[model samples]
Target: MSKRKQNLVGYLFALPWFIGFSVFLAYPLVASIYFSFCDYSVLKKPVFIGLDNYRELFADEVFWITVKNTAIYAAISLPAGMVMALGLAMLLNAKVPGTTFFRTVFFLPSLVPMVSLAVLWLWILNGEHGVLNEVLRMVGIRGPNWLGDPAWSKPALVVLGVWGVGNAVLIYLAGLQDVPTSLVEAAELDGASPWQKTRHVTIPMISPVILFNLIMGIIGTLQVFTVPYVMFPGGSPARSTYFYAMYLFDNAFLYNKMGYASALAWVIFAIILVLTGIQFLLARKWVHYEAGR
Candidate 1:
């Protein structure tokens, strides 16, 4: 066959994927961007409105509420999850007895189906009869109504979200395994304390993995939906759990404000882009990539 024929054959093979991308991903993205600038409802033809949707979105009280809630969730959950995962990974990295069993125990929660996990957490955090509260009662400590009260609701969600950090733990563990033992041995021979060695050697070596996990955690927290939605469908006790994605979902479907939702989604996309870019910029100072690896 001629080179041109071979090239045509390759293009034929790639056509399906190209078509799928154009139809599903690229087209929808472009459409949403356009829709965000118009006045669109599913039942009505979209009319170009020139940033009216964006202006209205900024003025909407619920938009600001959802932003505050999402920001709070991201601020609290991301660091807590990352720190917990790193600590767990460090513990599991130690050559302790029954480490495999403990690792399994820690990771099992992440494998639970989302619905099942939500239900389980609902029960566990129930104020009146929860196992957690019951234990607190035994210790003569009063347990707050976690999901019921607006003040405590987001924290409850954060706790539930942190339970699934097992994946992060595994990633950190992989990074830990890749750290050079030669550096560790040198630190030990230099009579470096355990904390000193971990701070100077292990952490710096695993900085790239830490950066990866941090960025992912930030994005995940920003787009948190299922857990909060399932736990508090009505936004619960005055919209404290009404996160950005949930608000966007309600605007798109429930409220029949497709344009507004599209605008909200674009805003979210912008926020994620900005935050992720900031992380990458800051990572230049900390994330250590080894030579030739």
Candidate 2:
């Protein structure tokens, strides 16, 4: 085969992915950008209304409420999940009996389908007949309405978020296993306590993985949906659990405000981009790589 034929063959192999990207990803993204500037309803043609959707979003009180709710959830859940996951990973990283079994048990929650998990948690956190409240009742303490009260609803969702930190645990476990033994041994020789070994050696070595998990956790928590949607339906009591993604979903589907939804989606995209960028920038100071060492 000649050079041109080989080139053609390579292009043929890449064509499917290129076509899919154009049709599925690129086109929709471009369309959404256009739609964001328009007044689009699913049933009717989109009318150009530059910045109207954005202006409405800025003026919309519920928009700010959802933003606040989403930010708080992400802020709390991200760090909490990271801490839980890292602790679990460290525990399992120890040479204990049945470590594999314990790892599997802890990681199993993440494998449960989101819808099923949501349903299970609904029953578990039920105000009256739930297992959690029952335990509290047995201990002579009454549990608050987890899914009902505005104050506790977001916290209940945070618990659910942390339960799925099994995924992060696995990631951290991998990072822990990859940490250089020589460094740990050196720390041990210097009379470093276990906590000191972990703080001075293990954690610094796994800083990259920590950064990775932090970024992913931030993104996931910010885009949290199904669980809250299933548990609370539209919005929780006083709209306390009305997250940004949920509100965006309502705008697009329930209210037939595709333009507003598009704007909201772009805003979310921008927020995620900015946050991830900031994380990367800050990682330079604390996230030590082997190359840096």
Candidate 3:
């Protein structure tokens, strides 16, 4: 095929995604950037109001609270969940008798739709008549109201995060498959124990994959909305599970503070960007890519 024809064909194939993105996603993003600077109340036309929305961000007490809650949730969930996932992956990699069964069991939760899973968990973690609390009772320990209590609500969501650890485990499993067998034997010959082999060779080789999952996990956690939004009531039971995205949604749709919500959106995007950048920077010290010296 001629060069021009090939280029034209490539563009034709790419056109659908480009058009959908521009219409559905890109337009909203650009609109939000403009919306962030306006005095929009959702009932009236937006009026340009420079940095007013941003200034309010600092003074906004609830915004700061949401930020803190979100940060705490992410800090608690990300490392813990990844560690759990890595541990599970390592165990699964050992080629157990029921490896496939365990893999299926682990991955079943991620397969379930988010709404369905949330509703199921709601009942399971209910203050009374719940299986989890009943199990606690079996152990002679009184269980707290998980969703109804503010202190336990966020932690409950972290527990829910376990359901999706299967996906991370799958990624780690793929990385494990790529690990060199010769390297393991060589390390064993050098008197390295199984722990040492994994610590030095297996982990370093899979560090890039680990880093990929970490980045995705961080971004996913930051934008977490549905699980908490559904599991606990929206901004409910003293607003304990009111995630940052949930708060942003409430401002825009429920409260009619469109401009402020847009401002919140921009801040979220910026925060994610900064956090991702920091991860890449810090990964230089820890994430061992094949090309890195």
Q: Per-residue lDDT for 1-293 in model 3, tens only? A: 99999999999999999999999999989999998999999789999999999999879989988898899899999998899999988998886699988888887878998899999998899899888999999999999999888889888889998777989999998998889999999999999998999999999999999999999999999999988887766767787777899999999999999999999999999999999999999998888776777
Best of the two (2, 3) by lDDT: 2
Clashes of each: 0, 0, 0
Q: Is candidate 1 or candidate 2 better by TM-score?
A: 2
**Colliding residue pairs in candidate 3:** none
Superposed Cα deviation of residue 83, candidate 3 (Å): 0.5
TM-score top scorer: 2
lDDT ranking of the models: 2, 1, 3
lDDT of 2 by residue, 1-293 (tens): 99999999999999999999999999999999999999998789999999999999999999999999999999899989999999999999999799999999998998999999999999999998999999999999999999899999999999999999988999999999999999999889999998899888999999999999999988899999999999998787889999999999999999999999999999999999999999999999999999974
In model 3, the Cα lDDT at residue 219 comes to 95
Model 2 spans > 4 angstroms off:
1-4
Question: Can you tell me which runs of candidate 3 are displaced by over 4 Å?
Answer: none
